[model samples]
Target: GQQVMQIPQYQHVQEGEDFTTYCNSSTTLSNIQWYKQRPGGHPVFLIQLVKSGEVKKQKRLTFQFGEAKKNSSLHITATQTTDVGTYFCMFSGGYNKLIFGAGTRLAVHP
Candidate 1:
């Protein structure tokens, strides 16, 4: 199926919680893009890094570009229920058809 599924498909946390998800790809990817999908909102591009050994952070989130570029990672600190949504990572290929990783769902409590 060429899909990567993360463990604990679902996660629930209190107002201040710690959450994490892992993604592994079948093949090497050129570029990795991360998107956040709100309950009723569309996928919005958060950030994109093309260079190897690249790292970027926004507020409470951290992103890393693997040295091999075949994999990547994202981490969040002090998660809030407001962070509820599915996060997807898209891999680029020859046909331009993006291969998306099974989304990681995060639910926070208040």
Candidate 2:
């Protein structure tokens, strides 16, 4: 079994501040998926990182995958109220199994 560990179990940031969450795994991962779950809402897929040393950005959100493919990070620049949610990093295992990290809950204050 594989496990993903995420740091900063909780984060509180001002509306214009930056926030980041780290995800690490002891084993190499084929791909990593990021999801955002808003309060009282289902999880929505954000993006997936597959290549080593890959970096992707969507608006103010930045995603990076480590060169070793054993780590990943999600950073939000200039946090907004809409960014308040639990961000999860997950990897798919064989047989339709998905392994998820503990997740980082973000709270934004306007």
Candidate 3:
């Protein structure tokens, strides 16, 4: 079975600091997706990567997929209070099943 895992289960940073989280898969993934969930809120899709060694950025956020398609990472610059949330990496596990990573919870304090 394919599975996704993430590191640094939790993170805390002062406002304006930077944050990053890593994600790995037990098996090679056809594609990977990233999401952000604000406290007490639902997960919101951030982006999807289909090509190996792909990199995408949105404002202060950056995402990268490994060349092997077995790992991924998200980096955020200049942390803000609104950025506080749990980040997740997900992959399709066949049969319409979605495999999700443990997620990385980030906290930003002013």
Tens digit of per-residue lDDT, candidate 1, span 1-110 = 45554445677877666776656666666778888899999988988868877889999988887787767777778898778998877777657677777778788888
- Runs of candidate 3 exceeding 4 Å displacement: none
lDDT of 2 by residue, 18-91 (tens): 99999999988899999999999989999999999999999999999999999999999999999999999999
The lDDT of model 3 is 0.94
User: If ranked by lDDT, best first, what sequence of candidates would result?
Assistant: 2, 3, 1
Error of 3 at 17 (Å): 1.1
What's the lDDT for all of these models? 0.76, 0.95, 0.94
Expressed as tens digits, the lDDT of each residue in 14-100 for candidate 3 is 999999999998688988999999999999999999899999999999999999999999999999999999999998878689889
**lDDT at 77 for candidate 3?**
96
Model 2 TM-score on a 0 to 1 scale: 0.97
Give the clashing residue pairs of candidate 2, or none: none
TM-score (C-alpha) between model 3 and the true structure: 0.96
Which parts of model 1 are misplaced by more than 4 Å? 1-8
